[model samples]
Target chain A: MSTAEPPAVAPGATVAELGEEALIALITPMLPHAPGELVGSGDDCAVLALPDGCAALSTDVLVEGRHFRAHWSTGHDVGRRAAAQNLADAAAMGALPTALVVGLVMPPTTTVDWVRDFAAGLAAGCRECGAGVVGGDLSAGESLMVAVTVVGDLQGRAPVLRSGARPGDAVVHVGTLGRSAAGWALLEAGLAPRAETIARAAACLDAFRAPRPPLHAGPALAAAGASSMMDVSDSLLRDAGRIARASSVVLDLGEPEAVLGADVELLEEVAAVLPGTRPRELARWWVLTGGEDHGLLATVPQASLGSLPDGARVIGRVREASAQGPGVLVGGRSAGADLGWDHFG
Target chain B: MSTAEPPAVAPGATVAELGEEALIALITPMLPHAPGELVGSGDDCAVLALPDGCAALSTDVLVEGRHFRAHWSTGHDVGRRAAAQNLADAAAMGALPTALVVGLVMPPTTTVDWVRDFAAGLAAGCRECGAGVVGGDLSAGESLMVAVTVVGDLQGRAPVLRSGARPGDAVVHVGTLGRSAAGWALLEAGLAPRAETIARAAACLDAFRAPRPPLHAGPALAAAGASSMMDVSDSLLRDAGRIARASSVVLDLGEPEAVLGADVELLEEVAAVLPGTRPRELARWWVLTGGEDHGLLATVPQASLGSLPDGARVIGRVREASAQGPGVLVGGRSAGADLGWDHFG
Candidate 1:
């Protein structure tokens, strides 16, 4: 990812030219430092710490066409997205990410610079989140896909599993919702992508590629005594539904306009993409069903709900679980049937 | 994989009918029980205990058309190969197999039964080495590629790193040297199409498709005070070269015949196809440079070598590194360079 591109790489130094050993040499220094990292990028296995009583783990995969468009997201963006998604899952469990292991597959024709940029994206994501890229494998592939597994340190807190949600908790979201979806729509429409802050839009597009999950948010929520939490990879509603179903509780959303923020450039972009359409429809769709944004979602009991830490906002409430569908309710209405992203639909 | 030949699922129902949720439901129960399994297969990550210490982790990718020819290995065989390779790496580290998480990508045209069989292979490999397929991500792809990360418990044993070999250590092999290489030659040569054990030659074909690493060989070496060990996924001469280079030592094979057993059969089959007298040359090539078959190579001090554990045998010994070159020696003569598999070349 050096924008100071001096013809990509030195002449005659192909990705194949580097091979596996040299490739490891090129990528190892980019990783963050971890305590129990007996083995990092080189060799076969990576050894990581567990401390006295805690271990948090999560993994996510991003296929080229299914989760991203190469034309829309740069290689760095793709790496970030891959790392972010996995990191989000670890955060959902109230874990502080310690190390990241990546498995990358790309066509042999792909440039060496692209792989470097991709690794840099993953490194930047981990660096920003305070985690290390511990180990990874690269193979000649037909299409691009990134698989990342994140191992985290809980610092002795009990993992907050999805099934740990209880009734009458406040449903909250950490980080902005619907921005990635809106950015995706803008890019899909061939519109020039811009945000209220050009940097924010770029960051949001970057978030779409490499999400900076509020890993700090999970520990904060746990410290704040939050009950149940999960990363919102799927839409807010769909992910909330997961907590609801797993916890056997009903999740009720307050209102759409109530959750809308003042900074709304992405919504405007979506509107520009579809002329004569209101931003509400696009935002509603993104909030309710779009998957892969990888923000964090949490639910807390009524008493502890007031203790939500920074970067989190109350978006809904949990109700009693019935025999019917379990999910967020809008205006006393359920988010209704599932429309979340499906792997094979 | 039903041994009784269960009905094959149509390609459309691959991941389509079962979906992600159903596929999880189908395989989660098949995983073996483990005390360290804090999390397994259900949630975003599979959690396991670190044995009051650290965990050894390794990942490898087996891509279709690159790692194994799909026509040779059944879908089940591919799955087994994917899981076993990683497990072997962990074992080579003297770590007890604890868990495995896989990221599998394939085209939508794959069959549900094929996936089910693949899962069976993964579960089987896990069972063979005291591990389980704890968690995995399923996605649609352009080709079938299985990426697996295997986690193991050290049980407090010092991890055997590739850099641990010393000048005075004895090199040893814990499994067969060149069966899989010969298997490939047999399949590539259509000479055995009419043999009585044509299916047997096909079994050799199966060997290349899915190498069953001697799972027990690793920990035993660790327990017997082996100094350094690694899995031979590339070739014997090549993988041994890795340990030598990493430890900055020289390896001398002392004239052990490189061919034995069914490897001779492979030469016979090749002779039938090419009709010349080149068994010695052909056998030499397969034993020296074939890839895939994951065998273990270790270096142990000779005093402790007599206490060699089951399945382990001294094949060579370490010598002082020379500035001229550092590599394997055969028959009191320097061996040819470029003796192992290099993916890029």
Candidate 2:
């Protein structure tokens, strides 16, 4: 729980004194290069042989305070979060995580243990995701940041994107959403729920920390006659809006009660803590716009709906093409309370 | 070019308000997907297929001030530099650039234009290097940081690494070192040479800002029977130390005079402006510990030295494995003006 990093050097060593040329000296011996590496570390580029003439790729970055709380998440947690998020992006594309390259930056005061732990966490994420940390560069910074680029193997399946959705397709979801936001609302307010719920909300917090996306969802949806798909990274409505806009169609979400009805209990707790006294009000926002849970949102043929596994829902459908700025229709009702997050807004 | 970014936004719409999910949503729609993207954006993982059963890979990151000055370099410069460093790394490995995935974190106040310029800069780097920006991700953070992963094709050449040197090999170098360090010092001191040398040094400044590694060196070295090779990211001596350490041999560097003798006039002006007198002193430092020129340093069999192109130098030689740590020697001397940059130091 300590956010204590190693003490910084007095003003830290300038890159000049350390010498840029010698930067490669510390790393060249520790790597295990692939025999197929057309060119490995030590040169301008590292080349490799490609399989079946295709390349799969994804990227993610973990920032201090935003994606993680230094006091709570360890260097390992940060590393895991960085790798997992990027690996998940590749997975969302229906690619099998192949290999990864990491860009690490931290304050000079950071403990070597933190760096070592960070590497271990990265290795763990790579191992679990069927990827390896091929090579990387290190630098000093004012804050801790880890950016990971994950390469993937598609095994020849067509890449799944948000642009392929079609009218008459069933809107389905695999994995949970909105939990992280709901959990944050409670945590930031300094209100603890019942033991079980606190544990559940903590799961939500963990979801934000080290998210494990459904790696198989892209291929599964692609193979299951799904016309279009995308990872639900924004609010459900906002992400759905992307699908609708890309496909030039409309998404008619089912009843709000059917969508987030199961979360009424947690909402009631949040309601108790806040002056505003309605569970329904908070519950609706969670399902509609909550992002970062990394669940899959797909539009599949109705017949494929039966084939979906547990934890998925037939939440809505892709309607005929529409121009009302491609969006989600709640209970076939008015554009309801705000949908999701906006980066530039 | 104008480096002015977008003005700040109203409060509360901050990253925390939208969270990671919402932030990702804002960007997912803007990225263009490629056919080779077996896994595009979205999902836990992406699967890619390569024809030859191997993949080229490398990674690099850019911090706001450490790697570049936002005021000096545009957003495009940041992106181009980010891509160039990684692509150069791939090339150093004798790999042909193929695809790239970027992991970026920046302040929410950043403009869409800045991001575009950054992307444009990256595209320019890839195009100049004959590569492409294949995939990437965007997120919010307090500071601006960029992480890039580049993949390339090696055309079946053996990868050249820092550990491949053998005893009795001729140590050679192709490209300028010390230029970047010297240029950095000049700029920091607020001294400017004539536009031509200034431009050249500015190119060196650009080299440090957005390095374009000698992409051709890696594959060429492998084809030309290079025994060992590495990029001039650190100082020549320090990086040479890595190869020496890995190969358990001594790399005897000739006097700095032998290397910079021809370039004396060009360096004299640079030396005059600095308070520490003498051209040789400043020039010598350039040859010893400078970095980011993206040049190639290689070793070849003494018999095959004639095959090298012009602008190449036989800077030193390898000797019997040394009991002393793997390091550089000057006329069997080790004054040890420490070489290369280190993050934690």
Candidate 3:
């Protein structure tokens, strides 16, 4: 048999022109090598050494047009967003991220540059949490789609579950709130941020594209005695409600203005530029209902509040479940409505 | 706060009408429960207790029109095939399957019954390999897609890598080969099998729709001292070439006819009914180059040949790499050309 050289990759080659083998060769080196990896790519499966007996697993899927638009997001943005969401799920369970496996389906005409950038972002995102891209599969489809599955090691710690919250716990949040949804609104409204609001607007856009989840805070909170924990992905009220239902308790936001005033204040500058917006009310609504910033939400014993992780603020408190049932309440009253994102609703 | 009952699900409801929450409620119960699971569905992530220190990870993606046409295969068939392929990758690495996480993208119009059946098939496939569906994500898209990632425990055994093969090793294969491709050909040609070939044709079609990979044989071969191994998802020649290149050796098929004659004979009955088909020659070609049956292909020392797992048969021998470099040779001559599947090509 003759050993033939693979065709040189062109600058503007489509995936169909480059073929699967060459495309794989191009992307493989971009993946971060894990220190615990026993076997890497080129095998039927990647063998990884888990740090502990218990492992946490989560998956997330992003579809073109539905989750993103090509014109609005770069390939890097898509990849980073996809990785961030799934990794956040593991962090929500107080686990340290370890590895990720990707499933990508793209139109045959997709450019090689786009895929290369996507791989770079994926590797970068995983590297941030000490994880690596271990294995993946690729296919051709009518539209671009990315599905990522992340694995995490608990490091001998018990997984912090939402069902562990108690009536005397303090409700805490440890990352940005509402910035992503605000950025999306700005994009949809086609409004450019004024000179005074440029930094906040940019931060909003950045959060919308590739969020910096407080992954380190997860394990720290658990170590400090968090009663229950989860990442706020579907809006503060909805996610808190999830913990409430699971724990059979009520999460009561004691003082809306005091608890969320800073987040509301940050959005007022951008809201001022929108023609029909009521700045103060809109900013408050955004803080209460906007989602996708991937903030860590938790409940801790009142005695352990002093030992909570950095960037954490007391947003509310847990109360006994009444005849009204487990739910989220503001100032001892029911929160307005659940405005969380739903794929089909 | 008010405790409200969820709307009752009606017969033949679409995903859009049921919404994300209710749809998930319907599907989660159908997933198999793992014995080692520390946590299951409803949490941000599922926590699993692995049996060993190391785990094997693999992913596979199946696009609607690209991988399977809905008119030819049911949703149950798609789900089963998706789970089976990923699990087979783990088996090929000599790992026992532990858990699976699925990412599904579907159109809003998909029926609840289709999803319920699909979950059943996925659960059944994982159950066969002693695994459970631990977690998954769902989204809406224009076309249906299934992405599955499986985790397997190595049980403290060293993994069998493709780079471990050496000269004088016996090249062996176990399980069916080329049957899925033959079934695909039958579907493409619109040639129904004659009465005499009905049973064989039915087997071919079943293989195409839902491949039954021999899961238990992988660890068996490894325990018996296999040097290298992989599943035959691509054509035999293409996969053999991979092993050769990785191991830096040449796989020499000294007696192709005697090695694969039985598989060739099994295809001839169906071939006889196709117009313009050379039954014997075409069947031989299929046995040589067709793929997607998920059979195990391995190399072992000659002394261990007698200890090989059940259904395994020697098909070739490994030789030191020559100046021509690593490749596959049939009867001491170069195999004509590679015709394995390429996702984008």
Name the better of 1 and 3 by lDDT: 3
Badly placed stretches (over 4 Å) of model 2 are A1-53, A192-197, A223-225, A260-277, A323-325, A334-338, B1-51, B108-117, B193-206, B302-311, B335-338
Compared with the true structure, all predictions reach lDDT values of: 0.72, 0.65, 0.84
Error of 2 at A296 (Å): 1.4
Scored on chain A only, each candidate's TM-score is 0.90, 0.79, 0.94
Candidate 2 recovers what fraction of true contacts? 0.69
Query: Local error of candidate 2 at A172, Å?
Result: 1.8
In model 1, the runs with Cα more than 4 Å from the true position are A1-13, A193-204, A263-270, A323-325, B1-12, B33-35, B190-203, B256-277
Model 3, range B1-345, lDDT digits (tens) per residue?
A: 011344477898999998888778878877887658889878888988877868888888999988888777777888888888888888888888889999889999999888888998898888887889988888999999999998888888999888888999999898887778778778778763442258888787778888888888888888878889998887888888888988999999754457876676768876775679898777767776887788888999999988888898899999999998988898778874366888997
TM-score of model 1, chain A?
A: 0.90
Worst 10 residues of 1 chain A by lDDT: A1-10
In model 3, the number of clashes is 0
TM-score of structure candidate 1: 0.92
Which candidate achieves the best TM-score against the true structure? 3
